[model samples]
Target: MNRKQEETETPSKYMNQMIRQQQKQLLRLLRKAGVMPDERIEVRDSELLIGLFSQIRRLPEFAEDKKKAAMLMHAMDTIFKFPVSRATVQKIYYRNKDF
Candidate 1:
C-alpha cells in the first residue's frame, strides 16, 4: 500500500520466486541425470547437502552445461534432500543426443 511496504513485498516475492526456481531446476537436473531417489529424502542439515554437492561436482564429465545441471541437482539435494535414481539418469542420457 505504502512505498516502503511495496518495496519490502517485492523483495520477499522475488526471493520466494528464486527459491522455487532453484528447486525446480534441481528436480529437472536429477530427472535429466536419472538420479531420482526411490524414497523421499529428508533434509538433516547443510553438511549432507555439501557432501552431495561435492560428490556431483567431482564427476569427470560434468563440465560446462553439464556442470550447471549438476550444480542445480546439488542445490536441490542440499535444500530438500531430493533422492535421485540411477534409472532416471540413464533415461535422460537417451533423451538427449549430446549427453
Candidate 2:
C-alpha cells in the first residue's frame, strides 16, 4: 500500500479520542446503577440467603468445608467487584487463600 493508505490504516489520534469517549459513556451508565462503588447489596430476606447457602451446600465438588467456604466467598467478591468472567472466577477459586 501507499504511504497515505498506510497512514489511514493505522488508528489515528481522533480514533483514540473517540474510543476514550465511548469508554467514559459506558462508565457513566454503570455509575447510574448502585453497583460501581462496591456497595453491599441487600437480598430479599433471610430465607433467600439461607436458600443460597443451602444450594451451595448441595454442590458435590468441594472436598472440604474450608474449600467450600473459600469458594463461596470468592464468588461473592466477584459478584461485587466487577462484571463476572469465567477466567476471573477460576482465578479467584485458585487464589482463595490470598483473600
Give the alpha carbon lDDT tens digit for every residue of 1-99 in model 1. 458868776556667799889988997888778897434456445344545554554456564457575566644544453344534433433243331
Q: RMSD, each candidate, Å? A: 13.6, 12.5
TM-scores for candidates 1 onward, in order: 0.28, 0.30
Determine which window of 10 residues in candidate 1 has minimal summed lDDT.
90-99
List lDDT for all candidates, in order: 0.54, 0.55
Query: Model 1: C-alpha RMSD to truth?
Result: 13.6
Off-target runs (Cα >4 Å) in candidate 2 are: 1-36, 63-65, 77-99
